[model samples]
Target: MPDDARDLDAEVRYAASPDVAWVEGPDRVALVDLRDPASATPQLCPEPAASLWRAVAEGPKGESQLVALANDVVGEQAEALVAAFLEALAGAGLVVAT
Candidate 1:
């Protein structure tokens, strides 16, 4: 387990990549590649956006754990940013905590 994983409250599961991310009750998926923006169809965002979405889709993995993961996958200063991102996703009906 990682340092922050030690103190988490909610269940957590790892995905393959951020591109495969999708909200599913208390869990989320992630993909490796970002979807092409120019395509005239639905597109997936890249990390750290995808990573943040994964967190929200997956539900609270404990704020601390999220902060750590965000720092690692996104950036050290992105913990708060990712938290806010998750909030926005939740607001947009794109993510829901179980």
Candidate 2:
């Protein structure tokens, strides 16, 4: 989902597709496919979410601006949700923090 197109909160709340992949068992971590409206999984769970974290860690944007961006479409819980999603990815070895 593009940030500019739809409200994150609204998208998560109403527009998200019903399909999500749970990749676990053989690996310690898991991969979840957050399907887009087009049904293509463009994000690789933690890696992309890690990129988001890198963006935050770099301090490129003020917390307010960043949080607003996180909240832009994701609402208040977006912060934690992104983190949990990333952690799940990391646990599966799909992504590693640099």
Candidate 3:
């Protein structure tokens, strides 16, 4: 996890990284980091990750909003799931805190 991941909270807002290029499929989403040509392979984002990705791509959202969006999918685990997702996204350079 990055230092920023430790700072995540209900009020922390996130948005998709400008360097990412994404394609949304019916079942999943694929992403490529344009900033790293050598590793710019498309990464598949499944399920809640895909949904969350789409949501953040639209605009910045706080941790609370993401948890709400993920609630239907993960139930009681929504908060932890969203937090883990945000941490991974931040570490992967796919999303940034704003």
Better of 1 and 2 by TM-score: 1
lDDT of 2 by residue, 35-80 (tens): 3535544343343344444443343333344445566546786677
Query: What 10-residue stretch in candidate 2 is worst by lDDT?
Result: 9-18
Q: lDDT of all the models against the reference?
A: 0.51, 0.42, 0.87
Error of 1 at 3 (Å): 14
lDDT of 1 by residue, 1-98 (tens): 88545545344432223333343232333322334434423335455666666654455455565677778865767767656756655454344444
Query: For all candidates, what are the clash counts?
Result: 8, 4, 0
Ranking of all predicted structures according to lDDT, beginning with the best and ending with the worst: 3, 1, 2
**TM-score of the candidate numbered 3?**
0.83
The whole-model C-alpha lDDT of candidate 1 against the native structure comes to 0.51
State every prediction's TM-score relative to the real structure. Answer: 0.47, 0.31, 0.83
From the highest TM-score down, the ranking of the candidates is: 3, 1, 2
Misplaced by over 4 Å in model 3 are 1-10
* Regions of model 1 farther than 4 Å from truth: 1-7, 10-43, 55-60
lDDT of model 2 at position 31:
33
Please give the RMSD to the true structure for each candidate, in Å. Answer: 9.2, 13.6, 6.4
